[model samples]
Every structure is written in structure tokens, then in C-alpha cells.
Target: MTIHTETIVDNGVNTEALIGARGAFTEMPEAAAFTFRSTCDWVSGTESSNAINGYFGLGQEHEREETFTIASDHPAVFAARDTAPTPPEIVLSALASCLTGGVAAVAQHRGIQLRKVQAIVEGDIDVRGILGMDPDIRNGFNSVRVRFEIDADATEEDIRALVAQSQKRSAVFDLLTNPTNVHVDLA
Candidate 1:
């Protein structure tokens, strides 16, 4: 049996010959790496679209099988059987985590040994407030109160100084209390 191949011709010229003549010179330029550095503009922005697969290291198999993603974590934890964690709970978690790390960093910097550090964070957000029913009431948490129990041997002054420094230096805390601008572009 004989096999036949068709030759590509353009204007009575062989296409392959033309391409070979062009060689590497006709190829497109090489691509370069595009690097970017970004900073968070919001202190307590709730992260969305993180596959509702459980905690760290848990794969998609653990995620919700339903089309309607179920909320877990804060307010959701406190809500009824069908509800999910609210935005306030996420905020409280961020603050609590920041405070814990800040205290630890300050103590480490000052050469103070920490026996234990505990914090109780209480935040109250009116359901109606979040629902946007009343214009006079705040939409978010009315107030976030934190009670810290430091077990370090350092004096009260030392603890106070550490807390102040942490509050001043923490990026998330600053974002929460300050104004931020957001820019968005669609391709």
C-alpha cells in the first residue's frame, strides 16, 4: 500500500519552505516574569471563595457537596442549625489573632518570658443593624471590647506599652480604624 501526503502551497510556493526560511527570526519574543507587591487595604475583610473545604491541609473532599455553600465559623456557629457565621465573627477573629501575635512579639522583643496570655473578645452587632433597616444605627459592630489577661512577670506598665506598640504597628488594626481607597478594573 502507498501513502500520499498533500503539500501546502501558497501562490505556487511551498509553505513549509517559506516557514523554514523564516526560521527562529520570525518567532515571537520570550516572555518575562511579572512581579507585584500588594498590601491589604482592609483590616477585617472576610475572605470569600476559599473552597469551603475544612481547615488548612484539608482537600476538596471535605468541602460542602451541595451547590449552596454553607457558612461555618463565627455568627454561623452561634446561629441556628441552618445559619452560618456572620461577618462580625470574622472581624473579631482577626482582631483576636492580631492581639495575640502582637503581645507575643512585644514580649519577645523586650526579653520578657510569657507564662500565658489570654483574651476574651466580645462584639455585639444588632441583627437589624446588619440588615440595614435603620439609617441611624451602625451597620457593623457597635463596639468590640477585649479583656486581656497577661501572665507575664512584667509590670502593668510593660504590658500597657506592649499593647500600645502592637496596636500602632499592626497593619490589620490600622486598616480597620482608617479610611482606604479601592480601585477595580475589568479586562
Candidate 2:
């Protein structure tokens, strides 16, 4: 088995662990209100930031089943061909893309020419647990594992170093491995 690796620079900070380190601030946003708009069929509303809207039709037949697409300045595309992405699936995709992009960005910045980058992502989530039907189990994914395939002319050590740097800088990777408080207020 060929062990693919990447190199990384450690700045003594594991960004993943600092998920909620900022805590609360004395001053909040002055507006306390925001707005966003989109014309694409795949995206709309302020929640989407106007880049793309994830769409799914309504009614009982569409419950938990609908197609999703992306409408951006570049192209209108489908997120998942057969069905819409659930909340957890979105997180998985975010991590996968982050690592892939991070590797390419770091390699280019460091003058390393990479031929290709590919990633396979997997996560474990128990529906019963997440639905609160099982009190003894955890509600979120227990763990996530990613497999990356990279094509570069660098040596084993060089590859390892690059991968390490990508991991350290990957924002989504940090979010998953870290804990944060999500507050929801209903008016």
C-alpha cells in the first residue's frame, strides 16, 4: 500500500479546538438586521448570501426528498443530482472541499506544481440518536474520516509536509473537530 502524505507547518495553534474561544463580546452589531437577495432558481433569501439557493419542492411527497442546485455567477449547477443535501451532508461536503482547496492553494503558494487533488469523505450519524429518540446516544456525527489523493512530483517528505499544512489551515476541518455553542432565539 502506498502511503500518501502531506507536510504541514504548525504555528502552535490547533484552529479546530478554538471553535468558540472568542466568547461573547460587549458590543454587538449596530444594525441588528441584515438582508440578502438572489435571482437564481437554486438560491434565494438572505440566509444564502445571494450566491446560490438550495431548492426543494413542497407537499407530502417532497418530504425529506427534493433536488438541490447551485446558481452562481459562474454556472447554475446541481448540488446533488438525485436528492437535496441534508444538514449533515452539507457539513461533509464543506470539509471535503476545504481540504482539497487548501492543498492546492498551499502548493501553489509554495511553488509546488500539483497535478491533481481528489477526496472521499465519510461521516457516521445515527438518526435515532440525532432525533432525540435515544437518550443515551450522541446527537451528532461520532467521527469523520477523509481520504485524499494527490498527484505531485514532490518526494514523500515533501508531500507529507504539504498535507500537514493543508490540515492546519482548513477552516471546515477545524469546525467539525471543535465544539461550539449554537444559539437559536425565536421571537
Candidate 3:
């Protein structure tokens, strides 16, 4: 089988390359089957940091590693030392990064030169649920709001359409907006 690949460069983004890879995936769905793995190990006190390391491309042709640290703590009022950002903050960061990436990709694909793209993702959580004060409340964010500030050579309507396209295609957005099954077992 012959595969065709082309490169479309727009402000440092290779739109054709991304499109080519997607085409390849569509041609061979099995090639797109991939499992991302991560492990978090508790390091110190209950309120201390946890070392997180992860890798991608377990069943694919390429692989990469990412490592980071996260902390869990409560405010002084809760009698715990506050260190790094909490887990929810990390979730927001992930969402922001994913959305920003989508914007960049979409702009490149549409041949729009972007000067800047910023995404602000915010989640509102009611602490009563986490504190076990209200069983009816949820233990997660009640709502999430995402706002984008884009500077590009395109009309506002075009930019809005691009953002919509990005949101429609973003994996992270889908993951958060939809239901996913997760299984946990002792390793």
C-alpha cells in the first residue's frame, strides 16, 4: 500500500502532517489503538507530594515519557500544610493545554496565522461535597467554563468557527464531556 504525506506549515504548525497522520489512522484503525499509562507514587506525608510518571504509545510506533509531581494538602484551617497546587488545578491546566493545542491545530489547518492564543479553563466546585457535609452535592466541579482569547488574521466569525471545530475534535474535551469506563485493580 502507498501512503501520501504532505506538510502545510502555518506559524510553526504542520497542518498537513496532522491531517496525513489522521488519514493514515482512518486507513488503518488498528494503528490508532493506543493505551496511555501513568503511575503515581506517594512520596511523603499524607499532605505531601506524589511523584507521577507516565508514558504513551504502548501499542503504537512511537513512545514518550512525562514525569511530574502533585501535592495534596488542606489550608491551615484544616490543619494541613498547603504546598503545591491541588489535583483540581492540574485538571484545569490539562484542559487549558488541550484546548489551546486544538486552537493552534485548527488555525494551522485553516491557514490562519495566529499571533497568540490563550485559553482560560475554570471549574467551580462546592467544597461541601468534598467535606462530606452534603451527600446530595457532587465531589467534583459543578460546572466548567472555557474562554479563549485569540489574536489571528481572521474574522471573528471564522475564529469562532475554528474554536468550535477544535472543541469538536479535542480528545480531552470529549473525555471530560462524555462518560468513560475506568477499571482499577491492584498491580
Candidate 4:
């Protein structure tokens, strides 16, 4: 006989535990607020590396399982070494990751099992703005698109609704769609 813990995992999410957490957060809404941070350092030739390991959540500090590092660099056309993915690519990745996680969580909560999830994310950018060739142009992607191919134990309408709900709850999606105040000064 196989033994199983009390955890009820569906689509890789602990549905039972999450339900309990939802109740806790509902009672103490302040605990639901979380702050995430990442530190980045410039390497050379438009190359930079970032590290993330700690965050504050549930009214307390928490550390990640391990330090995660990411590297970004510009292409050679911009006199860069093209060492790693570009920063914009990383943003797309973050969006995809957040959406995918939301999908899994939502599926688990709805008792839907996911078999496969694939996504293709793309962004359209014009370098003229960043290069200062046109002041009127924006220095970011003009548009971003994400297409998902998900195989789950649910109807097509349900899957579509799952993806839609994921987008509605995705932090990264909101960050990209809305404006955020950013301050950078000499430290």
C-alpha cells in the first residue's frame, strides 16, 4: 500500500493548503501583501546580472529555496557581447511564468488536471527610441502577445476561461499593462 500525506495536489498546486491559506488571508488581509526584490549588477558591454533570494510575505520575511540568478545582454548590433537574453526577453519570461503559475493554481482550485502547457510570447520593439533617433517614439515594446497551448482535463471553454482568469490575476501582466512608479537614485 502507498501512503500519501494530507496534501491534495492538483496541477502541481496544493489545492487544500491553498484553500486554507485563502481563508487565513481573508481574515488577515494584510498578510496577503508581498514584496519581492531583485538586485542587479552591471557586468560589461551592456551586460548585467541579477540575483533574487529573499522576499517579504505573510507579514514576515521569507527566503527562496536558493539564490536565483539571471543574466541579460544586448545584441552585437548595439556594441554588446550578446552573452545572454535581453532584458525585454526576461520581462516576457516573467509574464509567462506568472501567467502559467496562475493557470495551474486556478486549475487546481477548479479540480481540473493539466497535462501540457506551452506558451509563445513575443514583443515588438523599435530601437529608434532607445537610440535617441526619435524622441517621439517610446523606449519599450509597442505591443506584446502571448499564445498558450494547454492540454487539460476540462472543456475548451473552461480552458479558455482558465487562461483569461490567469491573465486577470497575473501580477506581471498587470505590471506590463499598467503604469508603475519607479525611482532610481545614487546609493
Candidate 5:
């Protein structure tokens, strides 16, 4: 198939650029290594704000067009104002976002024209774990579930494969499914 570098737009994604990136990564796999950074500051009682703007990827430093900030707060039941979703809620949303983007990108790459795509993500967590009420319970989600509703010019089997492929490629899914090493220290 003929590809136009500047004109192949699918699902609002630059397919040509994506293809170029795939080729580049295939040639120099190290370019795929990326480090993401975020800074969070305490705002008030159980409230914090996070800033995301810079990262290193494709063997170069990259900055976003604008800094994105998200504020988080605990619910009133937790003795804090319910002004914003808690950090756990943010995690759930981020997982949903990653999977949904992957689905769209995979669809575009496979030449599927999508009419609509929606995902509902839910995480089950026992607050007693975070509350220190149960030592046996983990302080994280026990499980996460995602449901996708996709309308596309593909069969149901194809749609299922698309979502499955998305999950297989999603970094967030891997992170959540596997154990990751984390270190916290006084700086």
C-alpha cells in the first residue's frame, strides 16, 4: 500500500508517523527506551497536585507542548474534602486511558475504521488495607476489570482481537499485572 508521510491520518492518529516510529524502533530498539517523570507537591490536608511535562524517549529529551497538572484529594468520608478523585481513582483512569489509546492505535494500524470506542474500568480495593486495619490485606487494588464497547467496520471476533492485542501491548496492563520494584527514600 502507498503511504503518504504527512497525509495518512486514521482515528486522529498519524499513521504514517506511527509506521515510521515502528520502523525506527525496529532498526534501533534502544530508541524505544523511555523514562517518564512526574512531580507532586502537597497542597493541603490529603490534597496534592502533580505536574507532567518532560520525559526522555526516542534517545532524546522531550517536553510536551504544555504542562499538564492534576489535583487529587481524598473523599469526605476519609476526613478530607471530596474535591477531586483520589490517587487510586486516578490510577484507574490512567489504565483506562492507556488501553483505550492502544485499541485506537491498533485499529488504525489494521485499517479498521471505528465509529465509537468506550471503556469502563473498575478496580476493587479494600480500604482496610490502606487504613492499616488489616495487615493481611494489600494496600493496592486486588483486581481491575475493563469493559470495552467498540463500533467498527470489523467483525466481533476482530474487535475482540483488537482489545486483546491492546491489552497485550499496554504498558499499564503489564505494570498492574506484574510486580514492580519500588523504592522510597528521604531525599
Candidate 6:
């Protein structure tokens, strides 16, 4: 199939330039080698809250330092006050944002103009697993669902295709679908 390329400028994204960059990366794989790092420190005397800080650039360009706080608590069961969203909720937010970004990029690349796009992400989890009440159950979300409400001029079929393509290209989706090695140690 012949890919018709069009220049799309919306929301600070240049689709034509993005497609060109992607083609360049396909030719030079080393150009795509990027590492992302972040550090999270525990806040307060308890372990209910954490302060996360990280830079938001690819490769050697560290860019700017971004910081945010996350917390979790139970009303009376855990003896802590609920302040911010739990870490799992933060993961859901990340997934939603990543998927939304992918959708926007794909739409732009396809020459489709979008009026608005919204995503709702939900994950099902059983507290018993984390509480050790059910040893057979996993300690994380059993399943996740993402629903998108997109307003665009494209046909429904084309919109569905856009979503599918976005899922295929989303980095966060790949990270959640694939296994990643993580190591931890006392400092």
C-alpha cells in the first residue's frame, strides 16, 4: 500500500517531521537507543507517601527536572490518611496518558484531524491478594480496560484502526505486555 504523507500541525506536533524522523530511526537503529530513569524517595516517617523526581528528556539531554508526590492510605484499616492517589492508580494514569499520546500521533500521521480525545482507564484488583489472604491470587491488577472517546471527522472504521495502530506503537503498552527485569538493593 502506498502511504500518503501529509503535513499536519496541531497541538505542537509536526506529523510530517515525526514520520521523517521515524524513517531515519528505522535506517539507523542506534539512534533509537534511549534510557529513561527516575528516583522515588519515601516521604514522612511511614511508607504511605513518596516523592518522585525525574528528568523528561531522551538520551544524554536531561532537560528539566520534574517532581510529583504519590500516596496511599486506608480510612481505619491502615491508620493513615488518604492524600494522593495510590501507586497503582498512578500506573493507570500513565497508561491512559501514553495511549492518548499514541492516538494523537497516529491520527496526525494518518492525516486525520481530531477535535477532542479522552480516555478512561480502569484496572481490576483484589485486595486479598496483597493482604496475603489469597496466596493463589496475584498482587497486581488482574486486568485493565481502556475506553476512548474521540471526536474526529474520520469514519468509525478508520477511528478504530487508528486506535489499534496506537496500541501497537505505544511504549507503555509494550512495557505492560512484556516482561521487564528490575533489580533492587539497600543503599
Q: What digit string (tens of lDDT, one per residue) describes model 2 on residues 1-187? A: 9998885534233444333332312133323222322333433321221233333322112222433443222112422333345557677888998888777766765657777778889999776885589998888888898888888867768877878898998878888888867666754
Report, for all candidates in order, the number of backbone clashes.
2, 15, 0, 0, 0, 0
The sequence of per-residue lDDT tens digits that candidate 4 reaches over residues 1-187 is: 9998664446778878988998999999999999999999999879999999999999999998999999999988788899999999999999999999989999988878899998889999999998899999999999999999999888999999999999998999999999999999998
Pick the winner on TM-score between candidates 2 and 5: 5
Which numbered prediction scores highest in TM-score against the true structure? 5
For model 6, how does the per-residue alpha-carbon lDDT over 3-118 read when each residue is reduced to its tens digit?
99865536445777887878988888676676656556566433465555544332344544656656754443556455556677878888998989888888877778888899
- Using lDDT as the yardstick, the better of models 3 and 5 is 5
What is the per-residue lDDT of model 1 for residues 12-118, given as tens digits with 9 covering 90 to 100? 22435434544633452221122223222222323332233232221112333533332433343334342345556657777877887877776765656677778
lDDT for position 171 in model 6:
83
Taking all chains together, each candidate's TM-score versus the true structure is 0.55, 0.57, 0.82, 0.91, 0.91, 0.81
Off by over 4 Å in 4: 1-9
With a 3 Å backbone cut-off (N, CA, C), the pairs that clash in candidate 6 are: none
**Candidate 2 stretches greater than 4 Å from native:** 1-82
How big is the positional error of residue 126 in model 5, measured in Å on the Cα after superposition?
Answer: 0.6
| Least well predicted 10-residue stretch by lDDT in candidate 1 | 29-38
Q: Give the range where candidate 3 is weakest over 10 consecutive residues by summed lDDT.
A: 55-64
The CA lDDT of each predicted structure is 0.59, 0.62, 0.78, 0.92, 0.91, 0.77
Better of 1 and 2 by lDDT: 2
Backbone clashes (count) for model 1: 2
RMSD of each: 22.9, 14.0, 6.0, 4.4, 3.9, 4.4
Candidate achieving the largest lDDT: 4
